[model samples]
Target: MIEHRRIAHSLVWSTVALGALALTGCATTDKGGSSNLPTPDAYAELRDARGADRGRVDIFRDSSGLRLEVVARGFGPGTYGMHVHAVGQCAAPDFSSAGPHWNPTGAQHGRDNPMGAHHGDLPNLVVESGMIGRATLHMVGSRLTGEGGLLDADGAAFVIHAGPDDMRTDPAGNSGGRVACGVIATPAG
Candidate 1:
């Protein structure tokens, strides 16, 4: 189990690193002329089944793609599978309203599958004993609006699962039940 966790961590980080590299071309100089980065675009507020506060997810967008950052707390100490679901609704008590993983390209689940990796596939979230977890990911060829946008008519959502994503299974990677969810929405300020 310990080794498996380590492997998962490595794979996830590697994927993130590659995604970051891919975004380099779309980047520009920072305010201090240091480095280019994705700009903040939208966000979401996560809640559990009973509507308890969980955390927040922020979305950043560049010319070519979008990035997601999830900062959450009040979870048990362990790794959990986090994903972007198709529907934006996060109805309480079950979060089934969020629907399944966002797969506009008709791909399978997980980054490790031979013929898989839906656009919604994300790294596993690891929470330490402090009960807090954070993860950042860049999804290439995705947008917040326009054709095939995440905020289309049906909308989209972020969901945290009860178990770790095996990163190779079909569908949801057998990540267990939906523990928390949030609807992606643009800020109104």
Candidate 2:
């Protein structure tokens, strides 16, 4: 009788542990089913025109939406406009090489625009006296893979402008010139 009681107690604890693990696994799945997205991926590297490491951007997928964490440094002390550009090139002096904002849906520019905001529209980054800024953005209607994704064939870039985004103008909200740019890429295994 004593041996049977001990076995039963051990079985109960083992079952509880297994149940917890199953719940944890289920929490990681996406709405449709299991998620195929990458977690904690260093998807992009930002740099200034002088080829200095200004920051890095990480991409992660969760049940809520796609999350982007932008860690920046060595920037002017003010609010700067940041966006995901269409191209991956970052030509120095002028970052026109980055092309325009990522707008796969043909939407108008600016988050405040009544027409629509571009897919790459993101909140402005505010830098203090230390010249550092960090922002975590939750992106809906976007993904890290598949069609119209950030990691698409042509690739995408992160662009930081000299001024704040007006959030209501077409073609870039008069965000001024691109002060810094970073191309998003997948890391090697």
Candidate 3:
């Protein structure tokens, strides 16, 4: 009787451990679904057109979704438009050359915009008098992947403007110059 009780207790504990493992596994995957996105090379900071030192951006994926954090410096005061622009090039002053917003589904601009919403259209970034500013944004699209977004291929670039992002403008938020820009190379090592 004693041996049988011990075996039953062991089985119960084993079952509980397996259940916990399953829960943890589910929590680590992306919210929408399992991502087939490739493993990113290494996270790299976006450089301004002049190659002057700008800021850095990092993207991470968890069970909830994708989180992008930007830490930049040397930007003057006033509100600036920050977003993920199409194409990885930052050669032009306006990033208009970077292509349209990073909208895979062809959505409009702004989170509040009723017309259309672009996947890459994020709120504006406000920089105080200081040289440094920070912005953190989140997205729940299943398309986000370490290889790039699940929808678009080539990849995308993060851009910082010199003016505020109206969030409803056609191409960009009518944001001024593309002061700083970084290509979403890959996840951090």
* Candidates' C-alpha lDDT: 0.87, 0.82, 0.69
Q: What does candidate 2 score on TM?
A: 0.76
The total of clashing pairs for model 2 equals 0
lDDT by residue for model 3 over 9-127, one digit each (tens)?
99999999999998866563212234444333323375677787687775766566667667788877778888787776666555566666677777777766888567787778788
lDDT for each residue of candidate 1 in 1-189, tens digit (9 for 90 to 100): 999999999999999999999898667632223345443588888999988889988898976688888888899899999999999999987889999998888998989988859889988999987888988888888888888889999999999999999998888889999999999988663
Tens digits of lDDT, candidate 2, 61-127:
7676578888888887899999999988898978898899998889999989999797899989988
| Alpha-carbon TM-score of each model against the true structure | 0.77, 0.76, 0.68
Pairwise lDDT winner, candidates 2 and 3:
2
Q: What is the lDDT of residue 155 in candidate 3?
A: 64
Candidate 1 to native Cα RMSD, angstroms: 15.6
Best by the lDDT measure: 1
> Residue 151, candidate 1: how far off, in angstroms?
0.4
Task: Give the clashing pairs for model 3.
Answer: 46-182, 107-117, 108-116, 108-117, 108-118, 143-150
lDDT of 2 at 78: 91
Q: When superposed on Cα atoms, how far off is each prediction in RMSD?
A: 15.6, 9.3, 11.4
Clashing pairs in 1: none
